[model samples]
Target: MLIFFKERLALLSVPKTGSTAYFKSLRDRADIVVSGPPDLKHAPVRRFDRFFQNIFLKMYDTELEVMAVVREPLDWLGSWYRYRSRPELLGHEKATHDLSFDAFVQGYLRTPRPAFADVGSQSEFFRTRSNGRGATHVFRYDNQQAILDFLQDRLDTEINLTRENVSPKRPMDIAPQTERRFRKIHAAEFDLYDRAR
Candidate 1:
C-alpha cells in the first residue's frame, strides 16, 4: 500500500493488478509505503480498516480515500497460475507446475481450494466495510493510462512506472465448460472488474 498524506489517498495493493510497478514509481513521493511482509502489503479493505484506519484517523486526523486496481477475473487467475508455475516454486506446496490451467481454475472453485489455486478474490479484497469504508477509486488492470493520469493529477507530479513482479507469459486457455462454472462461481469478481474504471 502507498499512502499520500497530503493527497489523502491510500493506494491499496490488489494482488496481480500491477501494483508493484505503481509502488516502485511512487514510493519516494508517498508518505507511507508498505511494501514488505506480504500480508501487510496485500492487506484487504477489512484488514486495513481493522488495523490501520483508526491509527491514521487518531494520529493524522485524516480519512484517506482508498484506491485499488482490479483485473479481469480470468486474467487474474491466469496470472496466479503462471506465477506459481515458476521454476522457483517447483517444490513448494503451492506450486502449479504439475497442473493445467483448467485444473488450477477448477481447484480455485473448490469450497476449500487446493494450495496451488488459493489466490484470493479481488472482490473480497475491495469489499466495503459495514461503515461504508472501501476503495473510493477503482481502476481496471488493462487501463494503465487511466491509473497514471489519476495518479499524476492527484499527486501533482509526473509519474513513470517500470514493470515489476510480472508473471511469466503463457497461454492460459480454460475449457469452456470449466470457464462457465468459474464464471458462475466467481460472478462477484467479474462484477467488480466491470464496475472498475
Candidate 2:
C-alpha cells in the first residue's frame, strides 16, 4: 500500500493506524484499482520508484487527483515497534535481531531511511520535481473522514468509507511520558501539527 499518491490514490501504508482497514475498504469500493510490481519483496524501493515514474506521475500529467494519509510520528513509531518486535510478526531469525525502541529510534535518526520505513512520508509521496513539493492534500489519520470528504469532492464521486481488518485486541496506551518524548523527538513534526491546528 506504500505506492506513490498521484493519479492513482496511493495509500502510503504507515504500518499501523488502520491502513489495513483503509486498504480493505478501497478494495471493496473499487473506486480505483490497485497493483504492485512482480518483484515486490526483493526490490520494493525500485518497484515504487519505477511505479511513480511510469505510472503515478504519468497519470497526474493527465489531470488525475492523487492523495494519501499520514499519522503522527509518535503513534506511528509505537505501532511500528509493536509490529516488528511482537513474536507473531517475525520468524526466529528476525526476532532474535530485534532492537529496543529507543535504539531503533536512534538508528533511524542516524540513517538516511524513509520516515517510519513503512509508509512513505509527506515528502516522499507529495513532492514533485518542479517544486510544488509533496502533495495537493494530506489527511491526518486521526481525521480520515474529512479527508474522504475532500476526496469525494475532488473525484466527483460518492465514497462511503468503512473499515475492515481491525485488530481484535487494543493497542497498549501511549503513556504521558512517552507522549512527551515523542513530541520532543519529532519537534518539527509537532510544530507543524500544532500549526495545522
Candidate 3:
C-alpha cells in the first residue's frame, strides 16, 4: 500500500493486479510506503477502514480516498495458477504444478478450497464495510493508462512503471463447465472489474 498523506489518498494493493510495479514507481513520491509482510502490504479494505482510515480521519479531519486495481476474475485466477506452477513451488502443498487450470479453478469454487486453489476473492478483498466505506477510485488491471493518468494528475509527477513479478508463460485453458461455475460463484468479481476505471 502507498499513502500520500498530503494528497489524502491511499493506494490499496489488490493482489495480482500489478500493484508491485506501481509501488516501485511511486514509493519515492508516497509519504508512506508499505512493501513488507505480505499481509500488511496487501491490507484489505476492511483492515484499512478499521486500523488506518479512522486514525487518519481523526488526525487530518478527513479520510483518504482509497484507490485500487481489480483484474478480470478469470485472468486473475489464471495468474495465480501460473504463479504457483513455477519450478520453485514444485511439490509444495499449495503449488499448482500438478493441476490443470480447470481443476485449479474448480477447486477454488469449493466452500473450503483445496490449499492449491485457495487464492482469495478480489471483490471480497475490496469489499466495503458496513459503514459503506471502500475504494473510491478503482482501476482495471488491464487499463494501465487510466490508473497512470489519475495518479499523474493527482500526484503531479510523471510515472514510468516497470513490470514486476511477471508469472511464467504457460497455456492456461479453463474447462467450459469450470468457467461457468467460476462466473456463477464469483460474479461480484466481474461486476467490480467492470466498474473500474
Residue pairs whose backbone atoms clash in candidate 3: none
Candidate 1 per-residue lDDT, tens place, 1-197, comes to 99898998989999999999989989999999898899999999888887778788889787888898999999999999999988899889999888889999999989898889988899899886797588889999999999999999999999888978878777787899999998998899999988999
| Stronger candidate by TM-score (1 vs 2) | 1
Give the residue spans of candidate 3 off by over 4 A. none
Candidate 1: worst-modelled 10 consecutive residues by lDDT: 163-172
Clashes of 2: 3
Best by TM-score: 3
TM match of model 1 to true structure: 0.96
Each prediction's RMSD over C-alphas, in Å, is 1.1, 5.9, 1.0
- TM-score of each model, paired residue for residue: 0.96, 0.56, 0.97
Considering summed lDDT, which 10 consecutive residues are worst modelled in model 3?
169-178
**Could you give candidate 2's per-residue lDDT for residues 32-63 as a string of tens digits?**
33434423411222333455435545765642
